[model samples]
Target: MKAQTANGFPSVQLVVVKNGRMIKNSAYGYISTVDDFGEPLMQKNKKPITKETLFDLASNTKMYTVNFALQKLISEEKISIYDKVQDFFPDFKDKKKALFKGKSDITVEDLLKHQAGFPAGAQYYVNKKITQKKKTDKRQNKEIVLELICNTPLIYSPRTEVLYSDIDYMLLGLIIEKVTGLPLDKYTEENLYKPLNLSSICYEPLKKGFTKEDITATEIRAVKRTKDEKFKDIKYMPVHGTVHDPEAYNAMDQVSGHAGLFANAESIAVLAQVMLNGGGYGNIKLFDSSVLNLFTSQGNFFSQAGLGWRRQGLNNSYAWAFSQLASADTIGHTGWTGTLTLIDPKEDLIIIIFTSAKNTPALFGRNLRGKYEGDFYLAKNYGAVTTLIYSAFKNYDNAMLDQMLIELAVGRNELINMIPEIYDNEGSRKDLTAIMESIKEQSKQSAILRKFLKSEKAAAILAEIQSRNSKKSLAKKQAEGQSK
Candidate 1:
């Protein structure tokens, strides 16, 4: 907490769980040091952060809203990951069919893996006023945003590459609503949160009766204007007890797939614990073990991502929130609003960090670096804390070390080049080689995995998976037709 405060972020809430029990739940720093207009305030104007302080979770909302929603639907057999985007919203079939042939090829799996080829995100909210002629038709905003996403040209062919995108998850949220006939928040609350007994997690906390005092303040809209021209002269206000992402706040009205949920550390820890327990907590089973495995396993994509969680791999940097010593199967995610959740299944550990760091001037071009340096500080703080936590567990066990060696040997030759930091002795080297030989003999995906390892192209492997799935689906349909 002190490191984060000294770096830039003012407030932080940390929760650590080991073996499904909370070991640490604490808060630090003030929620705000500046007022709504980015002006420095007196000490009396500041509010100290606490354990219960609600935080604008930003992209972390994806895990609870889009990811969990999809998992629930899949477990019910309502949808398959191989289902195409065109299958959900057929209106795209008639709209720009020739220009965007890739749209029809994009699958639910593509979006979940961020291999759908959508651009990162657009300031759709800023242009909404100019784009919409009828100002009073507020309900059409969602449709308009969807149209914008549909009209967007693909950056690459579907399943050809991985590009982390908010647009992908935005569409996933819409799919959840379309399939379940419930708002994203409603479905999650009734199905996931209620069962878990987590009452503190929800979308749009202010509308849900949370007071301004109960939630931490985020960025001032005015400060954001200096960085992006889209925000210039826009109605400025302090973000308190509300979503922070511009698209979620302005376009989606605090209900979006990519962002817009608010939560506290304790509630987030509960959710993480459920994930660590393989989709169950106590008597409640939100999903089957098979579903959890499918979602948390390493993807065939560029980033080693599962459905919505990022799996630890050799490519991951030390600045990442997960420990370097963590097993490859570890799954977790980070939020843009200074939040992190890491679940180490092998270690039976969960770590949650929530902060309102954007409330400080450092996030708005007022820091010593003279620009938004929050990302760097956020990574540093999260990485340092995670390292400290894992370090407490003593040396890495043989299983953990073996997994690291396999990962490094498979796709991370660069790490192998710097061997002293990883392999201390010739004995470890011989052990790694023997492990590799054993893996070569035992693994079923060895051939395919070797191809991907050699090529170092995650997109190619994932695309192959998609192609094979499509062929199987077509063959199944034909067989059914013949039987009938």
Candidate 2:
């Protein structure tokens, strides 16, 4: 792990895995809080965030739904990769008109790729009827979802352009329920987690390992006495311990197919390892490798999609685990609340980044204003390897520099030759320097790169050349400073 920060959140955890083993597992920031409205809320010594802390994994829940659907289909041999959404959910019939102005057809493949013509958000939270129900009454989430889709309009035909929609996955979840006799949660728990030995993952809050205060607080909304707010007190209503996303919380009764998955980084790692193992983690085969490959392979209809996972390097951004150093065969997804799990098949690696930053009222509503409807917002920064490499080289530590460069070379041999040039170019050099300065204090492994990244022994001949060039540039800068 490298570069963990609150960034105006309670806590965050970053992790790195290679060969199915954790190379770094680090935590940062406070876990509990004190004052809410000028008085103490949590009265104990603040517990620090750990890798085991259960985070609100907002949209990370999508992977589970996809996995469950795929697993069931594979089990029954009822569907193929080329299957269309129209095959099962014929309700998408206006699907022909769902395409963009000048596109082809929309496939199940397109929805998975996020190329479907649907907006990224919906206003499911503000529905007074849904919230007005007694807190003890079980939410009729399935019925609410039915009404939402029945009422909401489709933005465009499928496969038009890349527009993310929670409704798309929610529809898929409904499809899963249609195909399988059981509820989505029950099917997932019995089929997905039970088989994989994943005990900690869940959509609903559990009583054993958590409490009302254990969960992170997300937002603070202004309260109104009436619709006109003529008699309302001007104070923000405390939003803590509850699921922050209204549509997602409403979808699954706080346990939806698209969002509201709660799990620690460790449980996430186990799920990722299943993907790494080609649908089998240990002795158990969750699905055959062929089915796994089908899920991970991009099809002709969609430029970048596996069955449920998005292909890596789409839009120059990783759909998961930041951007990886591995091949495009990599697959993963990101949650709305700063949770991400990325799997790299080339290196057999899984990187899990989990944070409760979404629950912080400070950062929650800031970015959610302009276009997006979801009130939750999480920073998209990911995998710190590039920053680590740049830092090691800039600090002039020959050993640490050589080690990281060698690792990078081993990870991807082509990038090895470009190292010196990358360090020599003014723009690249400055970027590396800046990144190194920013992350150095927070990570001990990163600190090692600062001291020992120099060329060493017979293997580091390239590093020797790079070091000489760096030294010359440093001298020129120093001379220029003196002149100034």
Candidate 3:
């Protein structure tokens, strides 16, 4: 908690559940110390964040708004995942749709899997003229935004590859409205949230009667301006009790399919458990277990993606959030605003970490390598906390230890190399060596160890560890020589 606060994120709420039981629920840090303009205010004036403090779920909203709603609609036979997008919105077949040549064939399933080939999303809020009009009447502006999406060119042929796009879910939200004759929020609230009795989950929470004190602050920025110019005399203000995504805030006014849901850890845990229970919480079954399976099962095209949820990918593996202990069947999602939820049905585990990292000065963007990077606090804190949680659950049994050894062995050299970069003290180095020696002693009596000792994996682990240690010794010698 202290490390996260020092890294700039002001608050963090965590909840962990196993086998439908709440194992842990805790909160840390204040909601905000700096005001809207990034100026520090009196500590007494700021509210300490609690388990109930609502956070902007950001893209996490898609799981509820699109995935859950579609499950209900499909169960009711009102719509099919295979339904063509042009079937509901005929505009795609019109003359203006020529730009998106293959869009007419894009299926609801394609959009759900984010394989619809739409550009990520357009910043419709960047248009000053449209911004002024949107401020006056957001409903009208939403229609304008939809039209803009319709007219935008496809970046690739439909379903050629996975390219996650907010436009796809935005269109799905519009489809929900078209099918149910209710706004996305209303439909979701009535169908999913209310039925499950998740009171803290909703869109436009302030309008729903949640006060600013109940919501964590996000982003301190001057009044929004057009891409072509700046806003004259506009003063910076903290974004509080409002959606933080630019398109969701400026264009949709805190209600959108891809973003704009606000929730606390308790409400989030209920939803996760519902999914884990095979689409029911107690007696309330929103949809059949089969429907839940259809959404969570990996698609034929992308093994790392289900209909709307992200499965454990090889590169961005579950270890990124749930640690190496997570099962292959685990599915989860991470929000741009420092929120993460992981559900492992095999292990009957659910972990939820919610934080308002965007409230800090670190903004989301890319690095020179073009890999997306931001909010070092979120990355570091989440990694450390998850490691601690998994370690706490660690069993000393041979099977579990063998599994842990396999993972550690895969990256043993890299892990040793990271020690110098992470710890500056000789005491820490000695501690690490002692821990390694303890593991080595345990491995001597294990059957799995004897079987794998001559195997390629074990040999690789030993060779890497030796190579890295030698490199470290040489580097230390060179540094000492330079000093002399």
Candidate 4:
């Protein structure tokens, strides 16, 4: 953690729960070294990080908030996954003179599986969006945003591709509100969060009485996510104590279905524990066990994902937060703001990591060093914390774990070489790839757990980590014991 914080992230919170119990929970670093305008902050102005600090959940809100509401509605027979989305909203029809296609065929299940053919996202926060006829106020109205999505042509036919999109959950959030006649935040708080006693989990932490110091800042300054000329406005400030996602913040008023959630590590783990507990934590039942099974199991369209949760599968490598050593039943999701949640019902384990990965300035912009910027952030981050958590238990196959680590090391070689964005120039890319290749060669030739990392020798050096649990090591007598 000390080494990771040395990069660019302002803070990180990690919580590991095993067998329905919190085994480890901790927070590190500061609240903000810079204020909401990208201006520098004094040393005395920054606040210390703590376990109670809330963080932007980014996309993980799809699991804890949207998925939770869907499961509850399903349990009460208020809705079915097969129900067409048009059934809920009376005006959810294709626009009369728009290029919209196949709007009537979208099912609730397609939305959950992210096969509804919505684009990955739209920057509704920008004054001028593509599908809109005219620029509204600085932020878009919720009704207008929904209308835009409805009018926008489906990028692909529904059920043909498994692209992840915030639009799916944004619509689902509305569905929850429509059925319960309550806002998304109110419904989740009344039914799930408040009942579970999750004190710090909610949308719009600031409006709920949280100070800036109590929540991690996402960006040192808000930057344009698009190249549109209208996005040239310089009024953007550093985002703190608010939703980092543009659509959730600017369109749906920071209470959208896809994002706009803030919670500490422990609160998320407790919610994850509900899945492990078969739909209830303690006596507070949120849904039936059948709902849990239906949501967490692999979906027919994409085995890599369940309903809203990403599951362990052939495509699991993209989920940097989930460990390959985990049981095949592991289901989890990550956020753009650097939050992670993984729940394995088969192992009764839950891991949550909250990080403000974008706390650094975006002068260089996007993945320039996203992973290198923080140990908890991107492709450069490797199989360490989660893998070590799995190693702590006596169950999983040791040989398989070792093999997974080897593959990870090899993956680092392949992944970095493939991505041209992380490097500054061709020369830098060659230098970095060469360094990775050297490390891989060394790791292959040596059985001893010598320097295994390109940077820190032992950092994520999992090749021989299982040796610590070997019987041979345990059988050795105490060396030079004074009180034998």
On TM-score, the leading prediction is: 4
Ranking by TM-score: 4, 3, 1, 2
- Tell me the lDDT of candidate 4: 0.72
lDDT of each model, Cα atoms only? 0.71, 0.57, 0.73, 0.72
Better of 1 and 4 by TM-score: 4
Worst 10 residues of 1 by lDDT: 423-432
Candidate 3 — which residues are off by over 4 angstroms? 6-8, 42-44, 94-100, 132-139, 222-233, 313-318, 363-374, 378-381, 396-484
lDDT of 4 by residue, 1-484 (tens): 5434533347878888878778889887788768655787776777779999998988889998999988988999998999998898756666665444667889999999999888988666664553343554344467677766666667777888888888899999888888899988999999999998889999988889899879888776566543442423675667777787878876787899999989998888888888888788888888989988998877865667889888886666534567767677788888877777888777888888787766755534465544323332322242455776777674556454555555545554344446646633322332233333434555665443233453353443332233322533455544425347
Off by over 4 Å in 1: 2-8, 94-100, 128-138, 221-236, 314-319, 362-380, 395-484
State the lDDT of candidate 3 residue by residue for 1-484, as single tens digits.
5434532347788899977889999887778757655687676677788888998988889986788899888988999999998888777643454544687788999999888878888777766536566455645667777777766678777877788899888889988988999988999999999988788889998899899889988765535533433334455667788787888877665678999999998898998998899888988988888999998887655567889888875444556666666666678788888888888898788889888766654323232121111244433236545655666566546666665555544443344456533332222223233334444556688777666666776676566546656988999999999999
What's each prediction's TM-score?
0.75, 0.68, 0.76, 0.77
Best by lDDT: 3
Residue 63, candidate 4: how far off, in angstroms? Answer: 0.7
TM-score of 3: 0.76
Q: Cα lDDT for residue 246, model 2? A: 68
Model 3: clashing residue pairs? 36-237, 36-238
Q: Tell how far residue 175 is off in model 1, in angstroms.
A: 0.2
Error of 3 at 472 (Å): 30
Candidate 2 lDDT tens digits, 1-484: 2222322235666666777777767766555443444122452555666666677777778886556566547656865545666666554444244433312244555656666566786766566656555567665857666555545555775554567778667766766776777677778878888787777676665543576445554443524322432323545444444465667654456656677677778777887887788777778777777777777877434545566676664443453344434456777777766677777787576767776543333322333342221111122345444335224324646555545544433332222236543223332222233333333442355544444333252235344435755897899999999999
Candidate 1: deviation at residue 120, Å?
A: 0.7
